[model samples]
Target: MVLLHQLDFSYMFVAIILKQMTPEKVITITRFSVALSFCWPLPMTSSRNQIFGYKVAQMFSIVNVNLLLLPCFYAIYLRSDDIEIVAKCISQSICQIQSIAQTVTCFCKHDTLQRIVDELWTCIREAERYEKEIFRIYIARCGRFYGAYVAVAYTMTILYLWGPLFLPIMHVVYAEYPFDVNRTSMTAVVRAHQIIVSHQCCAHLCVCVFGAFLIWFTAARFECLGVEIQRCTDIRMLAVCIEKQLRLRRYAQDVISCFRFMILFVIMTCSLVMTLCAILIITKTSLLVEFMFLLVAFFFLLYLYMYAWPADHMKDMSLSVSRSVYELKWYDETVRMQKDLLNVLVCQSPLKLSINFLVPELSLRYYCTYVSNALSMCTALRAILDKTVA
Candidate 1:
């Protein structure tokens, strides 16, 4: 019965770890799918016809933007939830293990009990480090996402307020024709259409400008995170050199991955904005021209969502690998310390056991196991990052 209970507990632990890992993979895949779906052609037949094409295209653009972009936002929300869940699970696990170590201490020798205490303390510290890193990455990513939404909202507002003002202006601009010698006047319909199109062109320009600002802002923020991560890694390496157990390598890597993903999103967004700008500069006053620009903008917005979806996954993987690396390094240090202490104890040296207990056989073995796991996670994350770039 005791053996069965032990097995069951082990299974539960494994299950939790698996659950935490699964969400990272799922989030990455979903986000990528959302990004690719933006490139698909619109289904409206009227959008392609010269007479009614502009209105049809405009309607379809609205639909695509709402459908594609909204879901990407939803995906980010889900990923954030997953990160919080994993963090809580890790914290709880550490507490439980610590409690178990305390309970088992009464039956163990003084040296053995002390070693176990030290190891448990190390695990708690590593877990805390992991939690901190994950939280930081989450906040940064959220900031970029919020900034994007703000840009879109501002663009829509500009369009709504300015659209009506253009109707009269269009009538004035298109009313005078030099080549029509037989007729002395222009129709009210042509004038009104011209006014509306002119207003739309201005609106498109404003949206493009807003989008450019947002993308640039996001890119800059991501770059800052990259720099911070690099600093952290340097500090972590220094700690390692001093024989201190600190797990921060994975954190650094995650920062890099986040930056890469954000850059891709910004570049794509910038390209879309440039295309819209070019369309606006054309002197042609036809409705077809107006519709084409709106369609392109709508598709680009969908593409942005799709591009951003996988970002959470990449961030998660980076965090996991960093945590794993830190834990492994901590374990290795604990083992080394334990072995030195054991040596002192066996030699009947008059040295204090607490100070000498840094290295131990059990700790060394555990460190090896942890290191192996960390390496595996790192390798996996690296592969994912490569694929993302490709």
Candidate 2:
């Protein structure tokens, strides 16, 4: 009971966040996100459908991470003079955009996405059967922490946009590039443009948030599976729970494995994101704004570990289930009971929940490797960019 309450209280903040980050809610948000990104992060159009269309948005998400996409976008953002400096900045942004779009691909297929989310919900429901309060605590805590992390990161990003509105100094957000608004003196028109930008930014952030939530949900599922183990009674009925646990485990794996593309995308673009951050920070003009950007980059790494840590824990728990077999009163049980015990003991092998167990166990060691690799790549890319600048 004490453990129950501790788990319950620990997830207090998480509960608040989960209420808002449901799968249904995410789908609705994705619609706005799709609309905004294609229309250049603008919500509604000056005339509508001028730039935003079904083909345009669909084509962009599908091909945004293509090899040539980054270079093409960099070219578009280019100016006549200071090509070298602008080129570096554009390269960094390209890395960030491409990395993000890779995750977006996971949501492109509604049917696949629906199945994945259903599996997630099913795991949660199954876990609830054993310990309702404990599951609630873990899910809520996971939800809350991720929710808070995104909120802080988005606030910093938005402030970077809205800072000049409040500050005494009237520096344009990107004065160096100097984009001028070609608008008539219409207040409603200007407000509409602002709304578009706001929606576009929100959608971009939502993609990242959704990715984070997916990992958090997996962790919560593992918590449920682990908790069930401790509460597991060695009885004739134990066989039934074992079947349910296996089914739940498979479902969790299916959900995670479905997003293999997202993971691969992150891996491919991670080096660039790290490189971009490192280069910018070293040559950052504004300390405060760049720091916030750094925080945003850091959260990507945080999200990676959130997925890995629970997977590692789940691996330990699954293996530990077999150890329980050693302590059972197998001698006193009848033939059927002993047989069932034997079956479970054999089934509960050391399970490493990863992408087919090919990836390293999602633990601190793995996370350190991820960080180090990204940093190393960043070093190389920064060196190349530095020589280009010189």
Candidate 3:
């Protein structure tokens, strides 16, 4: 009865929190992101206690990731001869490491992140009805995509955690701990920890969604700027438009700068994981395991494409800002206004998001190239394996 009351209280507490978080009928991506990032150290709190709490959560998150990661490393060392098991452990470890990297990046750069969010919110508040409507449309679309991603990720986590119960496995995750998991108490504790860590891992993956949403936000702003340019009828309006265009350009660069390393890391890790998944699919005989690998590969590709598509759209929308200047009636304006417009055109270059200035611009073309390269690598790996077997 005591345990039942505690459970009821927990449920009620969760309900109250959710109620407070979503007072509005419609929940925007920003609000949903806030909820998803409850454990993340986003610079949202003002009180010292809240800041300390976030730090504590951040510490716990890092510890959880390492706890899972160390066990996977140990499992890899223990089962070096089993290719299938090693592949699974490596895949899981890579994900946890990625989570850790993302957490560290967010924690280190929360100030810049907060500034970007403030800029976005300022634009939203200052925007006209049409501009707000434009943002709303993009926000709605992103909210749906983010919602779907969280659903799929959490569903996979649930399946992964519960699979051992209905299968031949002894533990939830394929990890080796120093202690004996054969013992009931130890096993239960380890399994619960694994489940909690897996959920945390899923939450960390929402960083990808947050990044994509920022890109979409930039694109929508560019589209709004285009509209603003079209309405320019005088030097003052044109000046305002030009100022906004420059601001948007700076904003886009800031977004790229903040996420550049993350993009590079993701591309590198996803490429390797895709290749690993391909190898596993070829070597693993179990249909279930093969399907899981296939899903992982597909989702990674999809995540990459998510960034690529928006980045490409943002580039096009950015260029269209300068083009919108052409639609303005500059012929009737004075020579000085015409000269200023010409200068604006000359300065308007295409904005592209690259990975730390190393990779090419992120676009559908880049995404396609990555997919093709991943496939080629998979083919090469398969050939080598076949040759060895022969």
**What lDDT does the true structure give each of the candidates?**
0.34, 0.52, 0.74
Error of 1 at 286 (Å): 8.3
lDDT of 1 by residue, 231-300 (tens): 3333344334223212222222322322232333333443544344343334333454445444544544
Candidate of highest lDDT: 3
Q: Which stretches of candidate 3 lie over 4 Å from their true place?
A: 1-49, 139-143, 162-170, 281-285, 384-390
Among these predictions, the greatest TM-score belongs to 3
RMSD after Cα superposition, model 1: 27.1
Give the TM-score of each candidate: 0.22, 0.63, 0.85
Off by over 4 Å in 1: 1-137, 140-145, 165-302, 309-319, 322-326, 329-390
Q: Candidate 1 at residue 387, lDDT?
A: 75
